[model samples]
Target: MSSREAINVISILGSDYSIKAPVGEEQTLLNATRMLNATLADTKRKYPTLIGDKLLVLAALNLCSQQLEMKQRHQEELDRYQEQVNATVDVISRTIGKN
Candidate 1:
């Protein structure tokens, strides 16, 4: 591995995790670590018996749900923008055709 591809050590869920990423990926890594910790904590609180693969699965589901919600909201915004654009184009086309 190149020197620039050096792995960075980060703490997540009270465990040390070393991840290799781009130079500016520190913040992204931190954010992911934080999310994981939050998911683990929340799961542990809600289900005290959660352990092993079950914890990982629960965390993955929680993260996936968050991602899906964000994606849906983004798609809604894009659809609204497309509608506005189509309306503007329709008006412009009509105006040109009349002239």
Candidate 2:
């Protein structure tokens, strides 16, 4: 809705959607649509009888689950990095105190 936003059309689950995205985020929108479609395809293969809203819901759930797992993994990695930095700072402090 902002002045810098543009309408971009993306296809997912064999349907096209027109979304207003920030000018610089066209690729991100396209990428998200691609990811969703891929998830939808997988869900459809697993539940061939599902259609319409039910199929979309299942695919969205799968995507959400994957996103949560990735967020957890990313947080773990950040914690590990913080610990390493803290340890290095502690060592430096101790060495400086001895001087």
Best by lDDT: 2
lDDT of 2 at 61: 93
List, residue by residue over 47-80, the lDDT tens digit for candidate 1.
Answer: 9898867887998898899999999999999999
- Candidate 1: where are CA atoms >4 Å away? none
Off by over 4 Å in 2: none
lDDT of 2 by residue, 1-99 (tens): 888999998877667888999989989988988888888888999999999999999999999999999999999999999999999999999999999
**lDDT score, residue 24, model 1?**
79
The C-alpha local distance difference test score for the whole of candidate 1 amounts to 0.85
The lDDT values for all models are 0.85, 0.92
TM-score of 2: 0.91
Whole-model alpha-carbon lDDT for candidate 2: 0.92
